[model samples]
Target: MAPPSVLISGAGPTGLILALVLLQNGVSVRIIEKELKHRIGSRGSGVQPRTLELYNILGILPDIQKEGAPIATMAKYNPGEIEPSPSPKLPSGSSPPQTYRTYPNGLSISQERHEEILRDQLQKLSCSVELGSELRSFEQFSDHVVAKIVKTNADGKQVEESTNFHWLVGVDGARSIVHKQLGLSFLGETQEEHIALGDIAVEGVDPRFWHMWHVPPKLLVLRSSSSTSKVFMFAYTGRPEHLAENPPTREEFIEEFYDVTGRRDITFGPATWMSNWRPNLRMVDTMRSGRVFIAGGSPFMSPSRPSLNTHVPDATHCHSPTGGQGLNSSVQDAANLGGKLALVHKGLAPVALLDTYSEERIRVIAHMLKVTTELYHKMFSGAGPADPSAWKRGSDLNMLGVNYCGSLIVFEDAAGAGVSSDAYSRAAGSTVQAAYCAPDASGLVRAGSADAPTTLFAVFHVSMHTMLLFGGDAGAHAPVATVLGRFPEAAVRTVLVIPQGQTAADDGALFSAVLEDQAGHAYAGYGLTAGELAVVVVRPNGVVGAVVSNARGIERYFQKVLV
Candidate 1:
């Protein structure tokens, strides 16, 4: 049978990731962007730890590390002050035990650079974004979606194209044409306050820190990615009517900057990008309609960064970038949806699996809107964190705690059915639940091969479920393997996690791969004793699908999707 095809709107990080992941799973994908060229800005700069884990699976961690930097200290300045208040340090402790947390901190990189990396990864799969191509409209039939696209030529001519796709995903930003066409209501309110925002070259200011000037009813901020660049992102809040009545000019912006900073030493350079924005909190009640779906900021798109004063003036801002959850949430939305779609396309799972994408993601987005919007209110209410005390970025902001415990696809064996959803009660640093990111345990080596050491993360694949059998002794792995042997090897892979002294040779042909946990970290991380017999089923999206004590449990878990 011909592979199922998917059409994705928007070439931002969310769309790019969805396309790449689908392609990796042998699904055909065509992605388009409305922009004439790639966008430029440092809008969503925070890459949370959960997102970093996803990047690792995509094999783009090296690129992310090269281009991204950690969040710098925030330097607070009161209006008319020369010397800035002492910057506060980020809350620090060693990462939650190495077994549970691999990337404990978030990284900061401009949205433009982040998209460039995603595009590069997508290109490796022999696909590229179609620039100047817009999804004008699409009709969803019971079996397929017919989409009409408009493209602009270099000669300033327009061409129309139409295609049929088994699935259509809208990762387009706020005010998404796809969402509007699908009749999804973006339910939320728009704040009255507006913010003036721009990226510009500046003189005589250090870029090593994020600078903020606090004034009543207005907050000014200047930040740069690195010290070597003269370009900094500048923003200050105001009333919506004020900007409409007296549209800002270059001179006016410079005057406002001086007035807010109270420093004559700093000079403004040419503006690279500038706009005024009003924040809006909005979301769709449902993310999918038949074969047409919306995701990220709204359903799976990055929250309207432009509307929140990131890129464009007239846009939707369902979420503020205060906690840096905007981009991270968007990436996760794509990741979650992509995993389900890949399985359905490959025929390993029924189409019903796709329904869980909205079920799981809507909850996450709801929680995110609450946290980020609260931060926005705090900042605008003059009750935000002050100097000598930074906005404490806690574990919640890192996104490690995001889980889908209530997801329809997730199941728990009888023994694990009562494992509370609290992180404290679960294994160290984890919430004992099915729909959480599986912890990574290091000091793992293949049995008897003596190859380079590996970690649990090294074994994760984005396209299939991983079944780990706790083979405490030489004879405990066979039954687990027998149950896994029933499934297609490509859809469900079986691995035996054995103690250091165990060998694959002991298991004969029942188990093909044996992972030796040298320091017993894998056992401890999974909350197992030295000789406990258990099996863990990790879903394609990195959620722990089930933890069971025997073959019956494994059969029950696979029955959910694999017939």
Candidate 2:
């Protein structure tokens, strides 16, 4: 059989991440963008905690932190009132710490800069996106997909080409040609909520706060955005009866701004970009069709017998930018699908392994869509609570709780029973469940006489499955060593986490790495007993695939994933 190759449509962050991860794992990929040039402006500008963790694994968190800022505090105002309303006091109380996370809060960075980082990462891997190249159509066979493509040259000439690939992925926006070609229905309603939004150079506006006014006829907002000079993003949501069909011109925007804020003291400069946004609430039933699959905004869904087809996962999107999760969710979708595809390409797992991508992500997206939709209604519906406390950030938006608890590939031994996903929190430190991302914990590795401290986050392997053997005594370590030897070297890895005061050495032949639990964080974080031996199998995507007590359990878990 020919080696697996992939063709991805769209050069947005989703496609770039999917391509980058696939290429890093030695898979061949060709990515195409229909746009003539790179996109500009802050479209989906919020990066969630879960996405930050994914960025850490991809080795791009440093760059993202350098280029982004924290969420801006929203300052409220009323029409004809020059002074701002008092900042709503948040409920005074203490809650459980969010321990399952490293990057706790969401980051605010424009979508354009996010894509630049992804493209740069892809370039470092010796892969680049082909601009002005579009997927016109495709036909999928039992084994491969033939795609018809059109490319625009430097001279503005267009050429057509046809190519075949082992799989096809569509990350194109909502109006996806691939989805249309597959004849999938985008079954949902588009709301009447319309807003005029734009990026504008401005003066006399504080960058630290997101300014807003709940006027009679409309709600107006202004927040800082990264630009050549000081620029702000403005959104004007007028009454449904008064919204214009076309985007407002600069002159009209200035007049509306003055009327709403009653602040001629603030000056509005030229608009950098502007658009009319209509809140769309729709999605396809599934996210795959034959050998061609779609993710992000493509509304193509998988058939009932999805195990027989090649796979890529999906992420949901909404028209309203209530919470900045659109791009973050899409990147996560790519992360999950890319991890599975990498294993399949390496021949360590069968193609059936790809089926879980759709199964797991569909559940996540379904939950997310429901949550975001509820928030949208709560905010826009005239009946929404006026208290700022009512709109406070919650655990749902953080995305740290997303998991594949019921996925086919994840197996938990009897010891793991009752340790459900809800019990697996960084704050709880009582249980860590299978099918969720492994929690990071602190430990120490013996170096000569001195012990060096480290963390579970640092030891996670981005491209290989990490097998953490707790209670790393001689008896615990022996079974893991034998199991590691049985699997392909590139397929699995072993990290022996020993108890306190135990001297451990890196025997390159046996353990990939050895660490002593000098701090007991690993023991507590993973909810393991110092007296009992346990093994945790974490997938390339950082999700715990299984938790078992013996070597027999380890072998059984691998049987489900490996061919």
Candidate 3:
């Protein structure tokens, strides 16, 4: 039998990034897009820090950075020295101090340029893109999906083609054909909400202009990616009544632009792109069912930015022109989904691990929608005192801020109980801290303590009959993989072995290089090192349950936590 194959629809950054991630796991992928050619939509101009990290992983940032222009680190108005707000939300009375992180690895590249890079990467993979192809519909079964695709002809005629897929993902946009066919609920408002969009070119200038707004309705932005520069303008008016019957035209757009900006200096250059869109945000109630999954705007959603008044995930996967977060968020989504699928592909992790994708995304996007929607209402619509105060409560983009505070989320026995990272201004040692730790190097962050330099990798619960290896070497730092893999099923299993100087690949006998003889220590079989790589298993409440090699002994440790 052949290995599982997947059909990914849509070549937007989100779908493209997702395809790259899944392919890393040796899954068969075929990306089908309706466009026979590459087109850069003006949406999703900002790539967030997390998304940049993803590009770094793909080994394509140097190329992206080379092809794209650099973005200013600050949100500044032209001819004005930009002062940072405490955050999107600040204290009511006084101005909070201005601060910026430069996102360490964040960037602002045009949506088109980002897509170009992704397309290049996709070409390198075994799976190639199918242009002029549209997903007419699909049928899901226990093992695979049978999809009907439409092939457009030179005469604009459509012909139907049939194909089978082991798994399918709908990374298609909001008007997803797959979304409609799946009967998945895209619960949210759907109406033409606002009218105002444009692409402009500016000359003879300084480099760093992230975005700018005059006051009230006049919002303009300068963003770049892949050798292209774009400027957009927006207005706070009801959807064009005519759009309901027909698409908005350039003549109509000219009027809306003039009315909102109160100026005619802005004229459409070559009109690279244009759109009349509503600010409605919708998401699928579920991301997956059987062998199918949904991504991008089709499955996950958040409130769209209307003028600089909303929170959106950074621009890795998708970015809207509003807060410039659409692309960043989309890219991050791709990166995150990429990491999870990558690990799953390696078989180093379980299939159940894929379940976390929807769980984490729902929380992140929902909070973004709630907070950003409120920001729009306050900044554009009048801000009631209560609204501003409530919104102020959550302004920082802490990695730990978006928690899996939902139901399907269950603690991994190692998760500490109820320890909110926000409560402490200081760590257990009383030092100010920042950042959370995530399991595995995929960069799919999880809520961890203020622990510094936390070990970042996966811990496998292997069967007692298994032989373990770490970093391809045993006895190296953190050389042992599972100190507990060999323990009786009920006992705490902790494997922390780092070869003092040996690797499994280099040695004929892998276990001897850094195998733990912890049967004598307090941790008994707990994996540890006085000043070396270690793996220690603890109870969900943060009590030490097992370690590699401790002095006290392992028997009492299990007695304390296990029964």
Candidate 4:
């Protein structure tokens, strides 16, 4: 077969997710990791609600839900207190059922398990991560990238190989070779404080709430990772000079825990993984250099520097892990780029479409850095642990409100002109708007069938744009159909959403599917009323790209996105 179109360096969640999305779109991909084996530990364990929605479209939500646990509530203990004191509930904790959202709460699955699920999905597509294979260097041409890769053989001998691909993406963590070789500037501040994190076995702690104890200038948190096993994720901030070990010894961790909580009964076990995390508040000025790109592990921005372009990494952009946005933001970066890259590689969209990746992500990442940094300050602001506001996670962190409102590619008709462009300002409310995460609605029954009721989410495909024509007159369908016919059938899927008890004259042959909004959820989720006619285009990444009133609107929207 011909060479894969994309070469992805680093098989972490970002690379794996990008590879999966590209493969699903029929774009060939090769993913490599410098590590000989998969990394373990519950790093970035919080999978926010927005990420869960994306996972649903990727067809892995079931596995994630099955393997992951809900975000636990905090059980705060004051100094010398054994029993927990009432603590402020995190925004990620349990909540009332949401009418517009399918997955309303954050999940607690370790990064290792998250990657396992993604790798399994990719394996089903006949692709696998090449472990011990590292992207040593790469040179980008106008149309292709030549990369030198070093692979460690079974006997541990290293072999060098040179290959070419249409594009190269660096998801290789903070120290991204791609970002460096591309000459991108990662500008940010390195915080003075340090945090120690580890996954260790602990006995006598309840495996329910996230246990925490505050001893002024120092705080210790032990969050349960398993109900049956004794493993818990431990995080320590403000380590004293005497106990300042890089990877704290088991005895040191135990001593700190005992000193903070005064729990002499609690015993400690061996630690599986440990790290001394120093916050680096940085981001890249650019995210792309011709055919080469980067995502995840680094923080990135659009071009402001002359030398280069930029991920969720220290390479492109990196910040404190306060709101669990690093991994999820990295995944979002991949999701936003994968579809556009696939379309461009397949010659279905203009190469300029790829530029929007950096444009769209830079804003979101900037706001994310601000929010997470604020949370970091609040957590360590000399405020006692009992200060509920210190631990409070707002709904904005859920990322559902994250939007590409002012994106050059997204189009909002006059009907949606009232929708806010400021995602950060209106993040807490549920308002459907253009260039935002596509909301899910259940209780849709396919036309002319008695099959089990489905959902707007159930019909969304990762490989194509889903054009939902909401409550349009019969004549309106033909013009939209004609416009959509200009695009590849595989690239766009058309669905007709009608009000409950409405019957169409045809079997929806002009559309790929006809969904009867049995419970009015389809209209409600899209902020439309029954009998209202509008066209909503959900992009391959599950973002609402356009909210228009007619076929001309659909045409205008795609013109901005496709070739």
- lDDT (tens digit, per residue) of candidate 1 on 462-529: 88888887745555666777777888877887788887776666574566567889978788777665
Error at 94, model 2, angstroms: 10
Give each model's whole-structure lDDT. 0.73, 0.71, 0.45, 0.79
Per-residue error at 336 for model 2, in Å?
Answer: 0.8
Model 1 ranges with Cα > 4 A deviation: 1-4, 80-82, 90-94, 239-241, 244-247, 298-317, 385-390, 414-432
Q: How close is candidate 4 to the true structure, as a TM-score?
A: 0.93
TM-score of 2: 0.89
Clashes of each: 9, 7, 48, 19
TM-scores vs. true structure, each candidate: 0.91, 0.89, 0.64, 0.93
Query: Ten consecutive residues with minimal summed lDDT in candidate 3?
Result: 430-439
Candidate 2 Cα misplacement greater than 4 A, ranges? 1-4, 80-83, 88-100, 226-229, 239-242, 297-319, 415-429, 446-453, 505-509
Could you give candidate 4's per-residue lDDT for residues 1-563 as a string of tens digits? 67898999988788999999999899899999887777777667888888899988888889999888878788888876778887777675333233388777888887777889899999999999998898988888887899999999778999999999999999885466786687787776777766777788888878867888878888898877744457888889878886553556667778777777778888887787666666778877777778988887432221121110011124456877777888888889999999899888888889999899999888888888888888877887857465677777777788877888778888878654525546554323344556777889989998879989998877887788999888777787778888988988878899989888887666378888888988888787666765557888999988889888888999999998777
lDDT of model 2 at residue 226? 50
Better of 1 and 3 by lDDT: 1
lDDT of 2 by residue, 1-563 (tens): 65339999988778988897788678899999876777666656778777888787777889999888887676777766666787542121122242435676777787768889888888888788999898998998987899999999778899998988988998885456787788766656677666777678789777766788876557788877652336777878873454455567777888888887888888877777776666676666666776777776422122122221112123234434565556766887788888888887678888888877877777776666666666777777764436453476466577776777667888888543524443112223456668777777765664333656777777776677888887645755676688778888687878877777766644434787777777777777677876788899988877889988888889999998876
For candidate 4, the clash count comes to: 19
Candidate 3 TM-score versus the reference: 0.64
